[model samples]
Each structure stands twice: as structure tokens, then as C-alpha cells.
Target: MIKIGTIELDGRAVLAPMAGVTDRAYREICAGFGASYVVSEMVSSKALQFNDKKTGFLMDLGEAERPAGIQLFGDDPAVMAQAAKKAMAYRPDAIDINMGCPVPKVAGNGSGSALMKTPSLCGEIVAAVKEAVPVPVTVKIRKGWDKTSVNAVEIAKICEAAGADAIAVHGRTRDQMYEPPADWEIIRQVKEAVTIPVMGNGDVYTVQDAVRLLNETGCDLVMIGRGALGNPWIFQQINAYLTDSCRILPSPGLYERMSVMVKHIQRLCAYKDERHGMREARKHVGWYLKGMRGAAEFRRRAGTLETMDDLALLVRDIVAANSVAEEAGR
Candidate 1:
């Protein structure tokens, strides 16, 4: 059990806050699968300050998923503080500042990873948000703007001094943009430099990788990002690997996997409306079918689906066709 401030989480596996993903339904699913903590997708402080209806929708959380952190991105100190206050109404377990997003639109505005270039401003932002919210505040950051300016250790010190409860370090530079390998040494350096708990992110694709990261970096937790896509079962896999050296179980068979996909679609459809839910489920459907037999043909057919009923039919048909082909090959 790890403690971030006064709150004690059940374990050290956390879900990274991806912008389009990590919504309420996704968070609950990850929690059910044994993730210790889940962060909300990055919400714009400007949008929250303006009371944007869409941003408010993003903050909705069911009662069961407690100890969830709400992440906010913005360059302005006052606006960020105000946004934290507004977000507190939703009863997030903590508030996280996004100093790590490398996207041009977000960084171009001096928010996200752009803050890495200004340590003083980043400290001020952290201080303001920490003062404004009664809950614990944390910051997520990349290694630095690039190789020459690799300053996560310095920035992490500033954040810690400014009263952040913990820090999450993604080892890639801003220019890397989720490419190649993550520098575990950098995460180790940050963990060594900080007094608070440090969470490591990037390239943790399998249970072995997660265990290796925790052992190598000596970080308090491992945050899984792209690794969790269409594979929420990873939490259980990692936990198993951590406890024993034995090989973990493989993912479910094709029919069972399709059942999970269908359930994900149905939950999204219920949480959001059918039209929006079906639209959003398309990318997930594609992810679920990736590398499967005849996935290209299945995806082409699935893409044409416009309603939940159509989606269910396409999935059932694909599962049935695959099962028959496997039996014939035997």
C-alpha cells in the first residue's frame, strides 16, 4: 500500500490520464480490474472557468470510484486555481496539474509541457493550486523540453517545494512524443532526488516491463498509458507477475474477448447517449480487433455500423465466423 499525501491507495498500479480516453466508464472499468488509482482525462482550466458544458460532462464520476484525481491543463495561475476550486465540487480525491502533454495546441499556449521551460512559473502554478484546493495536489511532467534541457529533477524539486504531494515523471522528452524507449534512468534520478513518492510512466507494455520499471527505477508506482488500451486485464497480469515469477495467464479467447468488447460498447452507450457512445466506441473497436484473424475485413465491416444494434450484430458475426474457421482448420 502506497500513500499519496494522507490517502492510502490499495496498490501501486495507476492509470495514466489520456486525453480522449480515461473517462468515467473507463476509470470504473480499470478500478474493477484492480488499478489502484485512475486519473480523469485532461480538462482545460479555461473551459472549466467558463463553465463549459462539455468540460462539466467530463468531470462526472460515479460514487463507487473514489480516490480518483482530476487533471487540469492551463498556463494561467489564477485560472488554474479557480478551475481547481470548481473541480473540487465533483469531489476528486486529488487535483493534478498537467505539465507533460506535448501536443502543439496545448503547449503552444504555454500550458502542458511548455511549462517545463519555465520553472519559476511552474512553481507558482503549483503553489496557487495547492493553496486553492484543500485536497492533495500533484504534478505530471516529462523529462524536459528535449535532451539539452533535461530538467525534470530540477522541476520536480520545485514542485515538491511548492507543496505537491507526489510527482509522475514520463521519461520521454517533449520532442519524442511517445516514441522509442523511455529513459528509466531519468525516472530513477527523479525518484532519488525527490522526497515525495514518484510514479514512473512510459513503455510499460507488459507485466514484466512494469515490474522491471519499479525495481530498476525504485519508483513508488507504475502508471500504464498506451499499454492499457483494449487490455484492462493488464492490471491483474501485473499484479500476478509482481507476486510470483511464474508466467501469467494469456488474454481471454476470441469469443470471450468479443464479449468484453460488446460490454464496453454497451456501457459507453448507457453512460453517454447511443449516438455519441457508438461514435466513440469505433476507435476502441478497432483497438480490440487489432492483430486478430481477418481483422482488416472485420474492421471495414464494423466501421459501417451506425447504432448499438448494428455493432452487436457485427461483433457476433465476426466471433461466429472466426470460431467456424478455427474448427474447420482442426
Candidate 2:
């Protein structure tokens, strides 16, 4: 079990907070699949403080996604603190500070990974948020701004000193930005430098990678980001392997994948209007159908879907195509 302040997680794998992904529908799905914890996509502190309409929509969490954290991004300490207070009405299990977003729009504003360049500001923000929220306050950071300035250890120390309950270290410098070969050494160093729970992230796409991260860095948890895309089962598979000494199971069958895709879209439809939901489901459907037979053609067709009936037709066509391929192979 991993403890983030008073929040105790039953597993060791967490869902990383991706900006466009990790919404309420996705978080509830991951939680049902046995993720140790789930964090919401980054909500802008300034936006929340200003009572932005869409920002409030992002903060809504379902009951199933309990023990979740709402990640907030901004450089101003007062704005961040006020945002934390505003977020309390939603009753998140924790509030996570997003210090690792590499997007230029956020970083250019001295928030996100830009704060890594100023460790003092990082501490001040964490201290302020921690003071404002009654729940645990954690920080997610990158290795540093660039190769020449690797300060995760220093930043980790400062955050810990400033009363952060836990830290998540994404092992790539902001310069790397989702490139191949994350430097796990930085995560190890951060874990060593801080007494609070540390979560190791970046390049954890497979079960072996997740296990290697935990064993190598001694981090309290491993946060799955891109790996979990269209593969919520990764949480269940990793948990079984880590907690029970079970063999890593093969990927789900095509029929099961289709079922999940249908259910995922259905949930999105319920959360929003059917028209908008199907549009939002385009990328997720693409992710789910990736690497399967005739996926390219199916993906091309799936993009044109505009309503529930269109999506239903697409699923039927996919299944019929899969059946034909199976028989031909046999």
C-alpha cells in the first residue's frame, strides 16, 4: 500500500494526469479496473480562481473515482491557494500541483515545468497550497528544465521541506518531452533525496517497465501515462503481477476490446450530449483499434461517425471484418 498523506492506496500503479485525457469518465473507468489512484487533468489555477465555466466542469468527479486528486497548474501562489480552496467543494482526496507539463503555452507562463527553473517558487507554491487545503498536497515535477540543469533532487528536497506529502518525478527533462529513453537515474536520486512517498513516471508502458521502475528506483509507486491509453487493463494486469506473483496476462481479445470501446463511448455519451461525445470518442476509438487487423481502414471510417447510430454501425463493421479475417487465417 502507498500512502499519500492520509490517503492509502491499495495498489502501486496510478493514472497520470494527462491534460486532454483523464476526465471523469476515464478516471472512473481506471478506478474500477483497480488503479491505486487517479488524478484529474490539470485545471488552471487562474481559471478556477476566476470561476471559468469549463474549469468547473473539469473538476466534477464521480463517486467511483474516490481517493482522486485534482491537479492544478499556475505560477501565482495566491491564485493556486485560492484554487485549492475552490476545489475543496468537490472533495478531492488530494490536490496535486502540476509542475511537469511541458506544453509551451503553460511553461512559457512560468507554470508547469517552467517552475522547475525556479526551485524557490516551486516551494512557495507547494507551501501555499498545502496551507490552504485540509487534504494532502503533492507535487509532480520533471527532471529539470534541460540537460545542463538537472535539479530534481534539489527541487524534491525543497518541496519536501515545504510540507509536500508526496512527490511524482517524471524522469525526462522538459527538453526531452516524451522522447525515447527516459533517465530513471533522476527518479532514483529524487527518491533518495526525499523522505515522503515518491512516484516514478515516464516510459512505463509495459509490465516489465513498471516492475523495473519500482525495483530499480525504490519509488513508492509507478504512474502510468501513455501506457494506459486505450488499455485500462494495464492497471489490473500490473496489480495482479505485483501484488499476487501472477504471470503477466496477454492482451485482451478483440471482442473484449470492442466491448470496452462501446462502453467507453456510451459513458462519454452519458456524460455529455451524444453528438459531442461521439466526437470526443474519436481518439479513444482510434487508440483502442490500434495494431488490429485493418485498423487503418477502420480508423479512417470511424472518424466520419457523428452520432450514436453511426458509432454502432462502425462497431458492427469492425466485428464482421474481424470474423472474416479470423476465418481466412484459419
Winning model by TM-score: 2
Candidate 2 lDDT over residue span 1-330, tens digit each: 678999999999999999888888888888888888999999999899788889998899888988899999999999999999999988899999999999999999999999999999999999999999999999999999999999999999999999999999999999999985888999999998889999999898888999999999999999999999999989988998987766788889988999888888888889877888888888888888988889999899888878888888888998899999999999
Model 2 TM-score, all chains together:
0.98
| True-vs-predicted CA distance for residue 192, candidate 1, Å | 0.4
Cα deviation of 191, candidate 1, in Å: 0.5
Q: Would you list the C-alpha lDDT of every candidate in the order shown? A: 0.89, 0.91
Question: Model 2 Cα RMSD, Å?
Answer: 1.0
In model 2, residue pairs whose N, Cα or C atoms come closer than 3 Å (at least 3 residues apart or on different chains), thus clashing, are none
